[model samples]
Target chain A: MRVLVQEALFDAGAELNAFAKGDTDIGAVVSFTGVTRDVSGGLSRMLIEHYPGMTERALTQICEEAQTRWSLADVLVIHRFGTMEPGDNIMMVATASRHRADAFAAAEFLMDYLKSRAPFWKKEITADGSEWVAAKDSDEDALDRWS
Target chain B: MIDVLYFAWVRERIGIPKEKLETTATTVMDLVEELRAREERYALAFSDLSALRVAVDQDLSDFDAPLSGAREVAFFPPMTGG
Candidate 1:
């Protein structure tokens, strides 16, 4: 298992290939990538701010939980923070398991948990100004399924 | 003295990212009340507790959680991450 909290960009394809090559026992690999979106159509950049002291531990905990619940052979989580233009890759999660069901479920579970439980905040910078993105009730509700 | 930290708009509203405060509060809620009574910025930032979340020593916690032995407390809005 690997958890990375960084400001540098990563190649998602390389990450996936690297994860899949290590274990021959794994039959399937599932990956998900989150990208910044300009919902209002004029976003100049999205600034992601994360707690400097707590980010790595939080992500590690989340990945550990996923590992505990799933029959995963390998797990990788990479989340980026800092200013970036729209369409930049924000984060990615990959899960490898002996079966497709386990890999798919674990990947989805990781995405849901990271969406609301992680200690990161996003600010949308547009042509006019910047504004913090509010947490969605739907995201919180989504976590309930895992509980 | 305890270290209190703020994030996102809570930091912006309270005018600082972190501070050291000496207080007799026993719980997180009690500390919030004391800070709210200090000045308008704190009051404004803490106006609605429902919109905020708290962490004690970097672990997510509730307002009613005790502050005894905790060196740090953080207040912020619900996280928006993915």
Candidate 2:
């Protein structure tokens, strides 16, 4: 299991290949990459803010919860914070297991939890002004499927 | 005394990221009340509790949570992380 919270741009392809390499026993791997999207108002940038200590702790706990709930061999999570262009990558999660079902379910679970549980906040800086991204009720409701 | 932190728009509104506060309030809500009474900025930031979330000692918590020995408390809008 590996967790990284950084401000630097990372190559998602490299990370994916690195995670999928070796591990002879693993039969399945699932990954999700989140990217910054442009707002209808023309996004100039997206500023991500997070709690240094708490972000790491909360992500670790969420990953552990995923492991507990699924039969998985490994998990990787990388999240970035700082100023980013609309096309920039925001974060990624990968889960490996002996079964595709387990890997897919766990990856989705991680994404759902990360959307609301993580401390990071995104502010959309558009042509006119900047506004904080609001949490969606749908994101919170997505948790119901797991329980 | 405890350290109070704000993030995102809450920080923007309050004009500071964090501060050391002297408070006798026991619960998170009480502390929020004290902060709201401090000035208009705080009140405006905390105008709607439903749109906000709290954390005590870096752990997500409720407003009714007690601050018996907590060293830190954070207030922010609902997280929009992915």
Candidate 3:
């Protein structure tokens, strides 16, 4: 069972190593990591909000959707919600498959869905006041690539 | 009746995070119109529908989509969280 969500330390190297352990048939594992930014011109930390049951459901749905669209052997999605400092890993997705193309596409697809369709929200604590960050057009553009 | 949630700037504008609303509408747009008519705060919060996004039962949905049996509704700005 691939771990989908957790609220603890995420060691990227450990995750990849564990994913590939004794699985010689799996040729590729593509991964993406999202980190909290230190300088959004805001306060030192980022406050993330998400609907409890709904967030997990939404993320699982996106991962499943990616699976349906690609030939993926396994999918792992881990996202952290709450106060985060700069350089903290915010989210990570790892896709494994027998071929490199499928692994890469699944990883990209998962990220695109995460950026646009996920239910998480982030607020930047700034000197003036805490402010909600808006969705980036670049993210939308990123999602468009697979459409 | 449905539980409506507001987050981020929507909460700041509406001054609340969650509310129980009773309505007979079948679409998200209907709920928005009703909330906008409630008071100045709601109106201001929902003034620009283009800037907001709705989730029906936690799945992102469009404003005009039907909401006949939705147990929950959420209004928030476009997701900025990672």
Candidate 4:
């Protein structure tokens, strides 16, 4: 298991390739990438703020939980902080397992938990001004499916 | 002394990201009340607890969580992470 909290941009394809390489026992590898979105037409950039120590701790805990619930071979989570433009990759999660079912379920579980559990906040900057993105009720509801 | 940290709009409103302070408050809510009484900025920042979330020692916790031996406390809005 590898969990990285960084500000530098990462290549999703390369990370996926690295995570999937030389794993003879693994039958399925699932990867998910989150990209910054321009919800409003004027979105210029996004400022992601996070609790330095807590962000990593929470993400690690989420990944560990996923492992406990699924028969995963390995997991990789990389999340970016600081400034980013729309269309930029914000984070990625990869899960390798002996079967496709476990890989897919674990990947979805990680995403659902990461949405509200991680200590990261996003502020969208547009032509008019900047505003912190509000947490959606649907995101909170998404967690219930896993429980 | 306990380290108090704020993030996102809470940091913007409080005008600082983190601080070290001595307090007698025994719980997260008690500490919040103490800070709210200190200045208008804190009061405003904490006025709406429904919009805020608290963490004790870097773990997501409740406002009523005990702070007896906690070394750090953080306040922020609900996470918007991916």
Highest-scoring model, DockQ? 4
Error of 1 at A42 (Å): 0.4
Once fitted onto the true fold, the runs of candidate 4 whose alpha carbons sit more than 4 angstroms away are none
lDDT scores of the candidates, listed in order: 0.92, 0.94, 0.83, 0.96
Model 1 spans with C-alpha error above 4 angstroms: none
> What's the alpha carbon RMSD for model 2?
1.0
Model 3: per-residue Cα lDDT over A1-147, one tens digit each: 253555665887787767756777888889888988766555688888877777788888887888888888888888888888878888888988899999998888888878767778888887777877779989878877787
Model 3 chain A: which ten-residue window has the lowest total lDDT? A1-10
User: For candidate 2, what is the DockQ-based docking class?
Assistant: high
Going through the candidates in order, the fraction of native interface contacts each one reproduces equals: 0.86, 0.90, 0.57, 0.98
Cα-based lDDT at residue A21, candidate 1: 84
RMSD (Cα, Å) for all candidates, in order, is 0.9, 1.0, 1.9, 0.7
Q: Give candidate 3 misplaced runs (Cα > 4 Å).
A: A1-3, A40-43
For TM-score, candidate 3 versus 4, the one ahead is 4
- By DockQ: ranked, best first: 4, 2, 1, 3
For residues A1-147, write the lDDT of model 4, one tens digit per residue: 999999999999999999967879999999999999888889999999988989999999999999999999999999999999889999999999999999999999999999999999999999899999999999999999888
A43-118: candidate 2 lDDT, tens digit per residue: 9999999999999999999999999999999999999999999889999999999999999999999999999999
- Best by the TM-score measure: 4
Docking class of 4: high
